[model samples]
Target: MGWNDMQPLLVQATQETLWMVGLAALATVLLGLPLGLLLALTRRGGLLANAPVNKLVGTVVNVGRSLPFVILIVAIIPFTRWVTGTTLGWQAATVPLAVGAIPFFARLVETAVADVDGGLIEAVQAMGGGAWTVVRKALLPEALPALISALTTTVIALIGYSAMAGTVGGGGLGTLAINYGYMRFETTFMWVIAAELVVLVTLVQLVGEGLARSLDHKRPAAASRWTFRRSVPTQTSAAPEAAETAAQETELTGSALR
Candidate 1:
């Protein structure tokens, strides 16, 4: 296809890709966050610890996470149809995409929450805080940066999975690449779509990194440490000068007395 002919198709495909990825990411977060918290909190020594419950949830997550994305898409076609009343568009594609993503994202969340300091949780408990309070005030807040990073990684992964969905007639840039680029032998179109995907992923990574860095208070604390170091030398230099001046004054007073 000529550049002029491909523009509209590319635009529509790009929009479809975004729709699939955006909705799926939202679903992943909604379902995964709480599930992940459960996994983290129900562990052996966790606040709500229950060995059986933890093991069950972990096994479920592992099973979901173990399935290959393509196979998962195919395996869930009936469920997709039941959910969206169709199996060949952006909406239907979301079912598998979201399902594939939820466990992955939940695991990431588990890791993020696990990384929270035991001391902080203990402090909260000592202050008469409940489990929910510890999670809300200490765990979530302390792990916000890591959680954002994990979300970023998951979003990027979703973008790739969305492209894979195109192979199954799930409508997106991947579909465009497959139908127009590969099947039709339109190399130029394929290259353009590939470039667009690359650009989209790059932008997502940059934004994720920026947001994570912005939320990280350690950067400011480190900067303050540097400022303290810079100021210390001046104080030390002034103290020596002050001591010398005091000694000189004392000698002058003694000479005058003599």
Candidate 2:
């Protein structure tokens, strides 16, 4: 068929691809980010250090990472069928897509959060901050840029996985390429779809990189914000400024006395 005839199919496929990838990416973040945080915090010398727990989680993540996506998708077919009540279509595709991505994304997140300065964590803890406060005020904010990079990587991987899933009745550009281009021998249309995939990936990569750079560019101001928030005592936290800023003014007072 000509491009005119294939236009509708391509459009439908594109929408399906977006739907699958979007939902899968959301799931990846919801599940992966926390898993990553767990991995980071449970390591030896980490905030919640427990060797056994860290080892267990690390093993699981490693296994997840080791498995090839294509095999993982097929291997989880039963689970996918149970979850979505079907083994085909974009909706069903998300099960494996998310399953495949969570571990991968989690690893990236673990690395990102772990890369946060140890000094920051120490500073937070010295203020009598709890684990939750340390994570919120120190780890997450400081590691945000790297986390963005991790998220970008995860989304891009999801796009690729979504396309691969399409080949197995997942329903998207890959299916279109297979059904029309490869099966029907419509070489020209297949190339067009190929072009579309390239453009899609390129756009996503560019946007992600640009956002990361923007965040990096403003890191100085962001760092100042973190410092200010931590250094200053506020009325709202007067009762338990220990968790946020208990020791902040002591240095200033000591210096003034000198």
Candidate 3:
């Protein structure tokens, strides 16, 4: 087929991919954020430490993560149909996409939250802050960079999952590629679709990296300066004790001489 012949199909496929990815991302964030936080905060010695709960949640997350996407899609068909009222469209695709993604995203979020400094959490607690306050003001802020990176990974993974959705007539770029490139043996069409996927993945990575860098407060230059500033007061306070000691010695010597 000519380029013109493929243009409309490409547009439709792109739209379908975007719709699937966007909705899945939104759902993942909503469902995963709390689960991730819970996982991080309920581990042994964590804010809401509970070994049994943590173990259960961890097992479930691991199980979800371990399942193959194809199997997951098939396994969740009935639930997808119930939730979406159809198991064969972009909307239907989102059901499995979101379900599969939530646990994955939650684990990423847990890792990000765990990377937060323990001292920050302790500081918040010392200030009489509650769990939610500590999470909001300390954990999330401190781990913003890691969390942003995690979010990027989640989005990229969702794109891959959306491609798999094509098997069920989800009709994204994957479907277009399969229909023309595989079924019709149109090599050029396949290449075009492949190139688009690469570009999309690249763009997602670049944007995610940019956001991560922007959020990172641990850059050496700024961090070193901040550390120095924090230490200066302690150094200055010690100076007064040294000065007092010297003055007392001088006074004793003068009295002895008199």
Structural similarity to truth (TM-score) of each candidate? 0.85, 0.83, 0.84
lDDT of 2: 0.79
Candidate number with greatest lDDT? 1
Question: Any runs in candidate 3 off by more than 4 Å, and if so which?
Answer: 220-258
TM-score between candidate 1 and the true structure? 0.85
Residue 232 lDDT in model 1? 39
lDDT of each: 0.83, 0.79, 0.80
* lDDT tens per residue, model 1, 44-100: 788899899999999999888878888898999999999999999888998999999
Give, for candidate 3, the lowest lDDT window spanning 10 residues. 249-258
Model 3 per-residue lDDT tens digits across residues 12-94: 88999999899999999999988999999998889999999999999998888877877888999999989999988788898
The true-versus-predicted C-alpha distance at residue 189 of model 2, in Å, is 1.1
Alpha-carbon shift of residue 247 in model 2 (angstroms) = 44
Of candidate 1, the 10-residue stretch with the lowest lDDT total is: 249-258
